[model samples]
Target chain A: MISLKRTMLFIPGNNPSMLMNSIVFGSDCVIFDLEDAVSEKQKDAARILVRNGLKTLDFENTEVFVRINDISTKYWKNDLEEVMKGKINSILLPKTESPKSVKEAEKYIEELEKKYNIEKQITIMPLLETALGIENAFQIAKSSERIEGLFLGAEDLTADLGAKRTKEGKEILYSRSRVVTAAKAAKILAIDTPFTDVDDDEGLVKDTIFAKEIGFDGKASISPRHVDIINKIFMPSKEEIIYAHKVIDAIEKAEEEGKGVVSLEGKMIDAPIVNRARKVLLVLNKSRGVM
Target chain B: MKIKNIAIVGSLESNDVMITIEPLENKLEIIIESIVYDQFNEEIKKAVQDVCDELEVKQAKIKVNDRGALECTIKARMEAAIIRGKGEIL
Candidate 1:
């Protein structure tokens, strides 16, 4: 239900200061990183910190998500257990290769929801990291109902392809296209990978616009610095919001006047079109300055 | 003393406590929006009492820019701000 076309910041799960400051950073969604972002020795400590942070902090409008280690690792089970016990909204499953992986993760999440007495279902964002993950993307997208979105881990995908990642991401274009196509086929949102170069806000903005144009709903960020630019590029402009309001008002007025259809900017509008207009307004109202 | 007097006023009326803390008129001054003020009354009260009790502080006035924060989140920010203010004073 969340579009999240804007920036999603990745906060190291173990860093208390970063996590504490995350809510203030203004990202549309905040991903508490527990995967390659942290070292093995500190995984448990990170989990504790993230759990305590989740327990202690108020993330408000910022959605809280966790990136868990792949099930291939020994730490995956414990990671899932700790994540379930906390107040996390979703779990980002890394290196997702097949639908079975999603189903497996969903079962664990279901168990956690029951164990914790949580009312809402904790959703999953399966990250396609490897070539196989990309190849089997369709299955992974269908693996579970808890899966509301799919993510790209471009660096890992590049590694899997035996190619180097560049600013243009040309080497991995095929895989990226495949991932997007699969996500579209599954009717899921395609979340783009983060730009490793933290200081290059221009690069981040370019890529964000590119991804959005290419059908990605959002782009992930390793550093918070990339957030503002990415957010600006993807956020529905103020003009768009005002236009949405105008369209909604006109449609309602026309309906009240017993008109069959209405036109906006020389385009026809119907019932379904009204719903679309409402969604834009809803997003604007929901995000406001936060976006 | 009740050991601590911590209070988180919604960004809207959060200043009520802050205005009362001022020495000349015994008040604190802070600005906040109205919507956050209305929705967060309970959490504000509980957070203030808890902060006052937990941190062993006396009197506080907090202002927040709530873009629809959760109850737990409001409490967390209150605790964090109180602790931060305490840390600064000490």
Candidate 2:
């Protein structure tokens, strides 16, 4: 079953306690970060720690990803070397500015898979963190078969655009929408950036709701506390799930009666509505482990 | 990196391990304090020894206060303390 990434918690690669406790928080994915999270001097040690952590620990139900250093950094190669030696669900490429960067990382991942003698296909998550990355989001998402999604890196993109960062996130609305559009166009997931202000739970909820309204599939987070909230916010509500089941049942009954058009509660259930209902039910069933 | 002084890493909380390393005079010493000491004592000591060997530290005094941490946690904390003792940051 493909798990929905409603929230991905980022833990510093060098932090032992955090890494050990990562899965307990119940994030859909736990991203062990080796890029901006680790200082330059500690990159080697972080890599070793993350590699060993991935090899030794059972992450329970959470998907494991390693956020490697940017392509521009010398540490990216070593990051891939250490992380690919272990069992990983995906690799997050930071500051991905173009489709070329995604393909380059994909090539390196292939080489590493051969070197490590590992047979599993490691997916790639390219972070659209720069102005160029945001502009080229669709290309990056469609660049390679390994690319699973696009992640919005609002902080870096804001800096690249010379825009001021604010709690309201007004400056990044266009970029966020563009990323979601590009991801949708490329048939990939679009993950929104973290709220950054850990203490502002209300702000996080607001931002998450806005992201959902704008078609984002998930949100990235730095704090473990955000997991439960993000998961709760992103999941289909009880009423929505019930409605989806009713829609499916009604449609199936109609088809059995040889009717092409279906209606639920006096409202016409067209292809788009049925598709939305099916998606909701699919996500619900996946979360419940019934699919 | 070379061992220069004393350093401590990790925590003493539940599910965590705190490690302390000090420069020693040509010998390695490891002391472990764990609730599951009877079952994991040797394993914890081996973890510390392995980290020390990896860092090429010929001599050091290591102490572990483990609160039910697994072998990986022990190794990570020990490695972190070892790096910090060697005047490096992980």
Candidate 3:
């Protein structure tokens, strides 16, 4: 099933406690951060610590991904090699400039995959940070078979553009739309950039709803505190599930009568509509105990 | 018509806390539920798995209210509740 990951929680890989705590933080998934969170001297230590952490306990089905250093850094290759030896769900490639970077990283990942005989296919999330990256988001998403989704890296992007950051995210509107477009074009999830304000639940919820309305699959969250808001926005409501079931019921009845199309409450629902409706049901079923 | 092990369950919904206890074969099984599961439309069984460990538990019932609990907190609360109910050392 294709799940829309709405909130990818960031956990500093160097922090053992956070890593352990995130095993059940209740987000759609988590990205163990080795790039921005760890200092230069601590990179090696973070890697060792993270590797040990993965082996220590089960993350209890939370999708584990690591955002490694950019291709321009020395850590990129070694990160790939070490992560190859560790157990993780996915890899997030930082500073993705173009499809070429994806291809380059995929080569190492593929080599590592074969070397380890890892059974499951590893996923890649490409972070679009540079203007060149934004320009080629579409191509980058298309470049790798492992590329699963696209995330808007606003901090690095603002630095790259030499633009002042704002709380409203208006400065990155063009990039946000572009990232969503590229993700859609490639048929992958569009994840919004994280809300930097840690204490403002109101702002977080507001931004999350905005992202969801703008067709993002999920938003990146800097803190665990924001997971509930993001999760709520992404999941279909109980009313929505009820309606989805009603739609499915009507479709079933129509099929029984050998009808090609059906109208429910005066709105016609076709194949695509029913498919999306079914996805809502799946999400509802997964989160049954949460509320 | 005979009495066996009894399981009592209740919840006090806090902003971030929920507790559940299920009595298994012998040891007390306890679980601290996460509100995050409420948003997910699927099975609560996943949440159950999140809190369970290799610890022995039987004849358990859990109750809890939370103020935003983490995974470790959830599991720890469950374990603590079970031990408290079991008349065992904490």
Candidate 4:
């Protein structure tokens, strides 16, 4: 089963306090950001600190990811070399503008996997932060088999588009839709950009709900305080769970009766509806530790 | 390895250890000042020594200001400080 990624929290790579306590918060994934979070001078220190943390710290079930610098920078190769020395689940490649960049990173990762004798494949999540990235989202998603998700980075995207970002996010609506559509087409997860205003709980709720409505599998969070809210929004509701159970029961009954069709609450249950119901139950079961 | 210059890494924050490395002409010296010095002084010294051994440092003055950082953290800071002091790119 694919792991749930309802909330991916960003922790500064150099902050030891945050790295040690990363799993204390209930985020499904924690990203050690070596890109924008750390200064250029401290990049080496942060890289070593994060690598050692990954080597020694026990994060249990929380998925660990490292946000390496963009491939255009001189630090990206070094970042990958250091971080790959330890255990990590994925690499969040920032400012991914083309399929070539994805392939470049993938080639290096392949070499590292062989060098380190890493048994598990380290996946890549492309951050579509630039206008070109969003424009070529589908191509980028389809570029590599290791691309697990397409992450929308609205802040830089808006800056690149020369548009002013607002609370309601009218400026990023098109970019978000494009990214989600591309990710779905590629059969990968679609992650929403983080709500930057950490203090505005109400805004966060609205933003997350909108993201869910538009078919986002998860959302990135800068602060730990936002994890619970994002998780709640992405999780199937109680009513949805009950309905899913009912749908399953109806399908089983129809199968026992040798009926060709199934219906729940006077509505015909087609294959699509049944599949949706099964997905809901699957998520519910996974969340409840019934996996 | 020779310590070519003075280099510092890490911070004095909670759960972090600040390591400073400088060139020394004669002998290797290590000084540790941690909040939990009474409990972890020897362990911290061992962590620093292990990193020095890994980096093959023969002459240097190492100072560690530990805010209760873990063994792995101390080693990382020490390695980074040594590399920087050697004027090497990481």
Q: What is the DockQ of each candidate?
A: 0.04, 0.27, 0.02, 0.86
Where does candidate 4 stray beyond 4 Å?
A: A243-291
Candidate 3 stretches greater than 4 Å from native: A247-275, B1-90
Give the lDDT ranking, best first.
Answer: 4, 2, 3, 1
For candidate 3, write residues A1-291 as lDDT tens digits. Answer: 466476799998666567767857788788989899988865654665566556655876577898888889888877777666767988999999888888888888888899989888888999998889999989998997788899999998998998887878888889999999999899788999999989988888888888888888888988888888888889987787888999989999998999997999999997667877877876676577532
Q: After superposition, how far is residue A1 of candidate 1 from its true place, in Å?
A: 2.7
The CA lDDT of each predicted structure is: 0.71, 0.86, 0.73, 0.93
Worst 10 residues of 4 chain A by lDDT: A282-291
Model 2 chain B weakest lDDT span, ten residues long = B81-90
Candidate 2: regions farther than 4 A off: A238-279, A285-291, B1-28, B31-40, B50-69, B77-90
Q: For candidate 2, lDDT tens digit of each residue in A1-291?
A: 244788889998877778888888877899999988888766766787788899888886678999999888788887899788887999999999998898888889899999999898999999998999988888888999888889999998889999999889999999999999999898778999999999999999999999999999899999988888888789988898999899999999998999988888899998767876887886677577674
Better of 2 and 4 by DockQ: 4
As a whole number from 0 to 100, the lDDT of residue A51 in candidate 3 is 65
Candidate 3's docking class is: incorrect
- Model 1: residues >4 Å from true position, as ranges? A237-239, A250-279, B1-90
Please identify which of the two predictions, 3 or 4, would achieve the higher DockQ against the true structure. Answer: 4
Residue B44's C-alpha lDDT in candidate 2? 84
Model number with the top TM-score = 4
Residue A108 in candidate 1 has what lDDT?
Answer: 79
